[model samples]
Target: MDAIEKNLLKEVAELDSLPVGAYNIRANGQLAGRNTTANIDIVTKTDKPGIDIYIRPFTKNESVHIPVILSQTGLKDLVYNDFHIGEGADVTIIAGCGIHNCGGGNAEHDGIHTFWLAKNAKLRYVEKHYGEGDGRGKQIMNPTTIVHLAEGAEMEMETTQIAGVDDTIRKTGGDLAEGASLVVKEKIMTTGDQHAVTDFNVDLNGEGCSANIVSRSVAKDESKQEFISHINGNCACAGHSECDAIIMDHASVIASPALTANSVDASLIHEAAIGKIAGEQLIKLMTLGLTEKEAEDQIVNGFLK
Candidate 1:
């Protein structure tokens, strides 16, 4: 595979050939992408930071990709993707951003995505961010997402960030209406001197609305990571938020989970935890004939999975 293809696979392994409605964005510019099925009126414009995805009611699923890379120093890019889902639709979306910077300057990608889920719709959205380089260049990404769920709508979102992101800040905001639900699962890994911050704010705005937010991360070396999560119940609803992290070396981590209930019937809760690699667990794995590094690797892989 070519460098672009290899880099694409590193973040999205389930994709082989480009799927329908695939929007490919590179460091140089945007590519003439594919057209999806007729059920969904998907459009790609040449002048935008990213693509606009429109889904008709009951339209099929969509898969999208945005990969940015630089072999030299001092490159920056910003991407924005907007999604409009019609009422009573059920769809799954696979989307992510990747970067490969091998130069001496800084390479950055700021992705701003907004989603509107119509009434009674169900959406499964997954995204991953990654960075890799052989040079001393810095890799940075800032992702801001806004979600609006209509009455009785439901959205399940999963986001992951792999290694090599030198600096990153993630922010997500969500609003839910009557009988609507939102679930978010976020995972991250940081090594070396990398720094990362993740924050989420969500509001259950209508009767019977609910939300659950979970975040997990691992920091190694002098890397630092922070997780901030908040959920608000404005009506008679149920909600919960949790944050967990593992620290190693001189790494530092902070977990902050908060929940607010404004209505008399609103039930909300939050929990957070931070810890280091257990020595006894490492010793037990070593007794199985594995080295320290190998044991640590196994533990990390499992935890992230």
Candidate 2:
């Protein structure tokens, strides 16, 4: 890997070098490196431009890193990565994409990730998206995620996209079985003339199934953002979704949340809040000797964290 790729990896995945466990690195739409352990296997799909990851049953305390980087001009890369986790396994998956386009042509990467967790399995997934370049063209990313949790399974997801991307559309959906649970937290920031949209849909179809989804975002300058979430409880299930955003300058934010309950015992809730930073928050920080910009940055940082 070159210095640019290394820097991008550090920014997106916080990796100083190749990880110690199972991993795969993709750059410029091709495989750059790969390693698999005895309990986990990574295989490339012959019919697609992505890999399939398999974790054996009863495996625990292991992790996998699959990060993609793009440095080419006028390049559009699309990949489909699927994960199959065995029963009773507990593991973590780190995946993200970074792009550097320094030309007049646009650069884009679209990734679709699907996960299947067996009974009693637990998974922790993290994904980050970033873009950087001094170019006239745009940096665009569209990511879609699908999850399926079996009975007694659980999955927790953390996703963030803080800066540099010019345009993005993110979509996530999940289905939970009996006694299954799903939790998702997302953070995003947009500045300049950038635009971002997020959509989340979750279904709790079995008794005792539950889901919670939350998103926090900041829009600054002339940027625009939209968030839509839908939670459906079919059978004695519980679901909740929330969206919180801060708008600044001429930026605009729209949040739409929907909840549906088909069973009498099902419970669902949706909440959304969008507004500018409180003047008192800035004044309090300023009294502590911080500049106005610094105070605003600190507040936004803490809110997202």
Candidate 3:
């Protein structure tokens, strides 16, 4: 193993000795790296900090599952740099960002994540971005995630964003092999003058492959959110994509779902809708003796369903 990988293994061993909950690690002007057969949970806070994380299982038929959590904090811009997961590995990763700056300054974060799942492998991943109680911090987050699935592999991913006084952009893509399947769920909630854009794409490259994408967003109080979803069905594959949004009280939202079929035998479908909570529905619920707040909550809940 290289020096960086060895140093990472040592750092992880030290961290594992700590409590099981979440802990913050300061990588101030430091470089961290990990190699095969290493499972780590890391949280970084610094500027231009680098982390090279890799995971690869030992046996061919045997599967190993690794869980990872990444978080960002502080006023300076932090780069939670490149991460890679090898082929034929079962992995679950959760990555999130939170900026709690009471001052009137700005913060920025950038991340890149990549995964390669070999034949007959499975991966479940979740990503979230949230900012709370902002004072004037102009937070910018750019996250790019890519996945490659081999034959008979499966990947399920969910991404959520809640930004206040921040602007975020997220891009994700996946490539599937024969008989592979991929499912993606994206959710965004924005309030207090936030702006966000998200793009998702999936390509099926083999027969009997499938892909599905579902996107939902809620914007309120001058917040703006835009989402674009693309599903490409190639080589006699099947896929579906859907995007939906709800806007309220001077809020704005745009949703576009697109599907492209490259082969004549491929089956693909896409749908998108943008609207607000119906006042008539709320009134009907209120007439049944429910409070106004309760009625409005019910309407919002039903729309999400």
Candidate 4:
């Protein structure tokens, strides 16, 4: 492996040795690697960052993980991942993108993911984005996700963006059928002069369908972040969305959460709040012999965790 790939693998996957049933894709110019189980298949189209993943039916209690890394500097990469989860399946998906740039030009990664869950299926999807380097170039990431849930299907998606990304725009949407449910939790921490904008939308189109979304973020230094979430209930359904953020230094943030109900049996609600660390919490920790910096770190850790 080259030095850039090595750095990306270490910083992103946080492992020298890969785990069982793990699929790794190093997206420099095209789709370049793969390894997987019999129940799950991975295919890459002709020299593109687009990948198709198929999970066989009745593959209950199984888990699949795919980690994508971009180690090329002074370039732009567009990746599209399609996932098809079969009926009666219970699965957990761990997928994320990490980038390392060491050049002067711009380094950007745009990820587009679509998920299709069959009837009675349950899925827990987790994705985290991170970028790091000493280069003068900017590291920007744009992630777009769309999910479709069949009857009686349930999907819980969690997305996180750690430190070091310069700019990001995150967008996610969900469409739910009868007896279907979708839950999303997004966490982000931005430093320096980074900027992030996120938008989430959900349409509850079936009876007994439900959708819930929550966002947590911490902005430090001169960073700025904005979060917009909306949930629409077209049938007898329930929807909720909330945004919570911590603002530090000269950073700024905006949280806009809205919900609408068109059906008589629908119930929708939303809330948003932005604040900083309470001085009392820090003083309480200081009384336990921790320094101010240590106490601050502890609080950040707890909030993010």
- Top candidate on TM-score is 2
TM-score of every prediction relative to native: 0.92, 0.99, 0.76, 0.95
Comparing candidate 2 with candidate 3, which one achieves the higher TM-score? Answer: 2
Candidate 3 accuracy as lDDT: 0.65
After TM-score superposition, what is the CA distance of residue 89 in candidate 2 from its true location, in Å? 0.7
Candidate order, TM-score descending? 2, 4, 1, 3
Instruction: Give me the candidate number with maximum lDDT.
Output: 2
- What is the C-alpha lDDT profile of model 1 across 88-167, one tens digit per residue? 88887776666677667887878788999999988888888877777488888898999999999999999998777899
Candidate 3 off by > 4 Å: 1-49, 58-88, 163-165, 288-291, 301-305
Q: Candidate 2 has what TM-score? A: 0.99
Across 196-224, the per-residue lDDT of candidate 4 in tens digits comes to: 99999889998999988988899999999
Q: On residues 135-235, what C-alpha lDDT tens digit does candidate 3 reach at each position? A: 65566667788888888888888776644437888888889999999998887777778888888888889899999888887887899888887888778
How accurate locally is residue 117 in candidate 4, as Cα lDDT from 0 to 100?
95
Off by over 4 Å in 2: none
**Where does candidate 2 clash, by residue pair?**
none
Which lDDT value does model 3 have at 256? 73
The per-model lDDT (C-alpha) reads 0.80, 0.94, 0.65, 0.85
Model 4, which residues run further than 4 Å from truth?
2-4, 46-48
Alpha-carbon RMSD, each predicted model: 2.2, 0.7, 7.3, 1.7
